[model samples]
Target: MNDEKEPQANPWMKSLLIWVGILLALVLFVSMFDSSSRQPDGTSIAYSEFLARVDEGTVKSAEIAGNVVSGKLTNDQSFKTYAPSDPQLVDRLTAKGVEFRAKPEEQASFWMILVYQSLPFLLILGIAFFVMRQMQKNAGSGAMGFGKSRAKMLTEKQGRVTFDDVAGIDEAREELEEIVQFLKDPSRFARLGGKIPKGALLVGSPGTGKTLLARAIAGEANVPFFTISGSDFVEMFVGVGASRVRDMFEQAKKNAPCIVFIDEIDAVGRHRGAGLGNGNDEREQTLNQLLVEMDGFDANEGIIIVAATNRPDVLDPALLRPGRFDRQVIVPKPDIEGREKILAVHMKKTPLAPDVNARVIARGTPGFSGADLANLVNEAALLAARKGKRLVAMSEFEEAKDKVMMGAERRSMIMTEDEKKATAYHEAGHALVSLYIPGCDPLHKVTIIPRGRALGVTWNLPDRDRYSMTMKQMKARLSLCFGGRIAEQLIYGADELNTGASNDIQQATDMARSMVMEYGMSEKLGWLRYRDNQDEVFLGHSVSRAQNMSEETARLIDSEVRRLVEEGEARAREVLTDNLDELHRLAGALLEYETLSGDESKRVIKGESIGRDDAAGRRAAQMDTAGSSIPKSRRPGGGWDAAPQGA
Candidate 1:
């Protein structure tokens, strides 16, 4: 994805090349010492043979030093001999008509001489040459570049990402469209005395297409884009980050009307002293410079700053103020409609079977981000390829969604028959409850085939994206969640219950607690948030995550959560009891198939004439007429809001 020119490797490559050259020079030096041994017809001769050769005038030339002789013979062969302590050696050699000469008085190996006499100087020169070459090779990227802006400059033509390429988060796009218009024609807004916002901050969860949106803004405006990460500004050296920030802005000003996008800006924009380590970290200095640069520039300068981060809560207060980041665009998870568009964008080039429908795929994905959709498409394509299919099919998409949501099918996982049977019943319980429970999301699929850590998985996709749920819907969700556990209790009894419901219990408890403590649904807790969860602020609103409650109030909250879970369990128990025969039939179907579709579940629900208790029947009939608004008593740990009229 990073298409930057493979950074000037010449610098490091030059250093490596120098070391190689030095190694080669050392190898040559070693080879030069052995050069004499490579001569042709070289022979060893004793002193007597040397004397005879000299006497016969067959010795052409000879050199002697420290009683050792070396020379080429009359036959053009090279020879060497030792003449140890002959008092008349020189005189005798001269008298025998041999050309004789005395060798150097040092009498040491030439390589030794070179090493001892000149190695240090040569080594110093080589190191100096290496350093100089390294400096020249790394002319602009190390110390010099530490303070230089590392922003990747993309030209108008190179930036192919436009608003068309991005879907989902339509509101976010609308928010940035004005900036694009302003960039394209400043006079349109200036005529009305309107000033463009100095900065726009994109805050959202990860993989929500923050960076993609930023690029789309740049591409739409058709201006040079400078893209850099927040971490790029920070360096090991103090003040380097600040220097880079100033340099980056100066460059942006050079290319006027350009957009400056910083991804993951929280890296440098976090509140000071909030993190551990240095008191005046480079990150802090960089943030200060960024603040000054953003403020120093005029709103009419045609330069707009855009930053993306999920952790906006931890960002410095100054950075988020109106004058600094005038607009805070929230890029939330895509709704069903937006998800379909995003999928369409990613699937543009993909070959799909006739059965593939973007809307259907989108409906199955409730909370997927743009990145998730793209990944899902890719996963489906991969599955098609693995199965040797030429085109991706809806079945492949279904498999991919399951893989993305519940993890892989995990067919390799081995389980005992008893365990599989229990899992089947458990999953059957969930499917049946969801199928019959009004206001609950329709069941999608149920499988005893284990995936990830779950021994079985039951999937249900919501009818649509709901911003708020009715009380009836919440109650239905409660019963659906507890259906599995209640089924286990009914089939195996209390004595034979397994630990498989651990996750279900924890999730149900958390849901109940959130409803009571934060949602203020509990009558005793009233309409107040008993607990504050300290979290990042997005679009001018902060969801407090910090706890704010008395110990007694906390105890009451715990009791309320326990009461909700128990109530859900009791409701599930009653439903299962009324349809005990249907439960067995469904469990049998699940055991045989190991998987059941929603329609298959409905088929199992048909032909069931089980009768309900009088009170339950009256409540069910009343629920059909009521508007899903139920009133409860003022007491804590109490069951559902006031029961249906007849109950």
Candidate 2:
């Protein structure tokens, strides 16, 4: 019965048709009334008398009919008559005057009225049809757009970043070049039965230009590049993530031999079966679909997936297997030369003064990444602007570099005069100790003025890159870390030790603990590493179990660490005591200059006759204590003879 019922007409059209019909009916009714109201003589007459005269021949010249009469009058004039046709109307007309006239040709016919009324309906139907058709078209377009991959495609002309635009990643670039060549000529390698890698994973810490490298690949290959974030896949709805993965792959396949780069893949590719609760189930599903698409039945399709993640360990192992990601590129922190190149790249657009040196800036920033270098340049330019300088000078960059690494200099930080003096002497002690320690890098600068949260800072610039460290180097560093507190105890008694040495103490303690527990540099422990448990936590849940260790061994590890720190502290006190007068002189110089370089501090320690290299050699020979569990032999015959001692 429901199917048998015909659909109702559209309300919008029905109302339009009804209004048109009413207008036509009103026009016809008005025309009929006009035809009945007037006489041929242009004068009103009683309707009954007029009808009587029309019916009788006394008014013989007028012919009478239903509501109409026409005749030739006695005066030879054409005439017409009008009256009510019914008997009831005739009775009413006997008391009322009425007149009539012939209807004009301009009055429309019934057929014409019907045609005029239906015109509007036809016009409305056409307009409604056009609107509905347009809406359907737009709806289809919108749906198609939703399934399209959000990856940005960049052609050669559109991509401004190329291999030349990238810096500080020479090895990564060389590896990526193979992909670029494959994109340029796929058949060359295909003819030799060599299949291009399906994917390459870029793993590194944040701000290391993983995204920038992907762009360079696209620009170099001159192919369509698709870039999207890992988070783009997972949506609130179930199956949405998988659907997006399918859509993304479909898009990449359509643009065959293209690169599809996903940044921060860990967002979707977290290790399955690790996360607690059902919240991550959708993400896991998305990751599963991605794995299938990467290495399933259609694995060798021309699409090359490039993904980047800082936390590669958290990614699904399936995704990183041989057939899936295929290759993993580690973009670690830049080294000295890499840093210099990165600094140079960022400095190109900066308005640097003639004396500004990229090498100096690179040397100052030790652990900075490519993004950090860019930010450093921008910060230097800002400082220059603040000073109203025409160009960024070397001094501005120096200040900016310090601001980036150590934080902004707080010259206005308030402290008591006694506190200030104590800080100055403490920093001077650190400088003095580092100066006399062999294998310790030369001091870059020592400033008693407060910077960031630090009451004072002693900057040590390494003479060269040292990938490996010996026991002498570690012990020397420990002594330097303890020197500040040692100086306070010696000059102003143990009561003078303030919170200023908190960071130094913590660092010294950590080093001591690592030496005893991890590095096995303790005499009694003898090559035993106590640290076995190292579990990483994600989202407040432990990803793995901790290793078990006995309480007795833990106590022994603690004792060894404490012994190392105490011995280092005693040595610091002894060194500071012997150099007390020189320490005072160095502190006084620092108070005057607000900063003392490594060379100036060394001059205060040994005078002009003792060159930096000679002083370093002497210090190395003096620190060779027997029975001390120094990890490596400290001999002056090696490259230690070449480095400047203090600076």
Candidate 3:
């Protein structure tokens, strides 16, 4: 890629240039008028001296014009003087035998006179107009264009992205392909008595590529595309949003058979009167105009409206009705196969090593979306470049995945021996519990190294993509959550346990409560949902969503949640007590290695070594070669850096 230089002129420089031009024009106009009124340069004397000269007949030939007089002396020298209101001035010149001639007074041309009169008004008007233009530009549109549409027309010159460029979410893509087909050949649907869909609503979580799908439709149809955000229509003043909506539709009608994509429609299409107090009148009015444009009495045939939003629940019902948004397409997180395809698409741009397997990476990231896969590929390439590698290897991809999933490792943070010991035991407890539990996910890795905000982490991997959880799985997960606390309690006395398990305790409690209240998994709650649906913070207190259950029932709910938690804690303690030796062994291995993969952890629990002697020997050799200049505490086998050389 080539580097581009910045333009020579900046905004302030342009403003300065404009001011300079204005000043120059004012100077030129002033000079024109000044030159017309200025008196001729010549010798000047008083009116009395001029009269004496005229009486002496020294002024041979006097010339008079307006309020000044100029003539030549008898010696052929020129002189000038101001004349008073003397009626006999001309007669005196005549009697003096001065051969005077009275020239007609000079007058400006008609056009020059008009210019002198109107120059100041023109300058004022020009300045005012320029200032207004700058203000309107800052306000997003010109002064006369507040009501005009802000939708940007997209063309091939802007870089076209077609359906071929989109990957994953095939079902959503297939749903929209029909709209593209109709756009290309409206007669096919028309001949079959089928009317084209007025609009298609793309709903999904953020980063699911709803906007990308809209662009693909425009590219496939080969028609004009106008893109705008929902907030673009809204203004602080009332009626402006409505006018913009009308104007946007007008532009779309002028370019018939085009697509207009509104991103984040929930910004303007939120349900009216849902919140407490007065709603946003301007936003509501804009939404009303948008609704009318989509499905009102006027038939906007040949025009297609495509809108995307993550928060569809907050959108007004009128905007999502049959005619307005005829189809609702869901863009969900990609599954394993979809992930492979998405990774493949992004990997095409990256130089990959032979060991980089898209399938393996896809299986590891079960719930990744198209955007997430793209980011993963980018991060892998960046990691390879940072390491000065020619191509991205599988190890780089794995490291990138860890960074994206659990955050980068914080090796610079200092930890005491006691802290590392406690963290190792805590993570070991969770891993040991997961290994013993019936329905727990398989343990992937356990580490005592600080990462993100945690002192240690025990990661678990599901065998496949799981959409729902069984009651057994939920109970097992609850036990897994408490295992860290239970291990801490067993290693250190209950009173001596650290705050390492605070998050674990909170997560377990919430899960247990959700199982009872929301999932209706508890016998006490039966098969009915005890959770409130209304978002109180969103709707405010004026709208009541309080569950009408009695105080007794609330107390029962609390007791049930506590009972489930206690049961999980008891189960975790039982497992840890039975496998006390294995817990100690795993924790000791973590202290030695600082990290253990699933297989390594299993081997450690089984009383098998993972070949650490060779790595230790290599580190000792490097230290010896470096001599005694290095401090013993800061050596390879010292302090927190005591891990094996290449581990």
Q: Which candidate is the best by TM-score?
A: 1
Give the range of the ten consecutive residues with the poorest summed lDDT in model 2: 636-645
Give the lDDT of residue 70 in candidate 1: 84
lDDT against true structure, model 2: 0.72
CA lDDT, candidate 3, residue 316: 89
lDDT of 3 by residue, 1-647 (tens): 12222343466676788788789879979899789878866788888999998888788887788778988899988889999789999888888787877777788899988988898888898798769768775444876688888999999877798988888889999999999999999999989899988999999988888999999999999999999999898888888999999998999999999999999999889999975536548888888889999999999989999999998889888888899999899999888888888888888889899999998899888777788888899999999999999999999998898888777889999988777766776788889999999999988888887778777888888888989999999999999987877776665554454455667778888899888878888886798877777655554554325477999988988999999998888898889888876776787788778888888888777777666643423332333343532333321121111111100
What RMSD, rounded to one decimal, does every model reach?
A: 9.3, 15.2, 8.2
Candidate order by lDDT, decreasing, is 3, 1, 2
- What stretches of model 2 exceed 4 Å from their correct place? 1-149, 155-159, 278-280, 538-546, 606-647
Per lDDT, the best of the predicted structures is 3
lDDT of 2 by residue, 1-647 (tens): 44323333354565577667667756765665576454455334565665565454344344445566565534555555455546654333333333323344245589766756776676577666655654554331344344444566666545468888888888988888999999999999999999888899998899988999988988888778888888888766677678778888888889887889999899999988878747446788888889989999875477899999998878888999988899998887788899999888888888889999888778778878899989999999999999999899999888887788767878777777667666776788788888876767788888876777777788887766567778988988888887776665655654333455667878888799888767879888888766654666689986544246688877877888888888777777778778766766676565556666777777755533223334423333332335422212321111101000111
Write one digit per residue (lDDT tens) for candidate 1, span 115-199.
Answer: 7567657867998877666555432365435677888888754647999999988999999999999999999999999989989
Model 2: residue 7 alpha-carbon error in angstroms: 43
Superposed by TM-score, candidate 2 places the C-alpha of residue 325 at a distance from the truth, in angstroms, of 0.8
Candidate 3: give the clashing pairs: none
What is the C-alpha local distance difference test score of each model? 0.78, 0.72, 0.82
| Residue 285 local lDDT, model 2 | 80
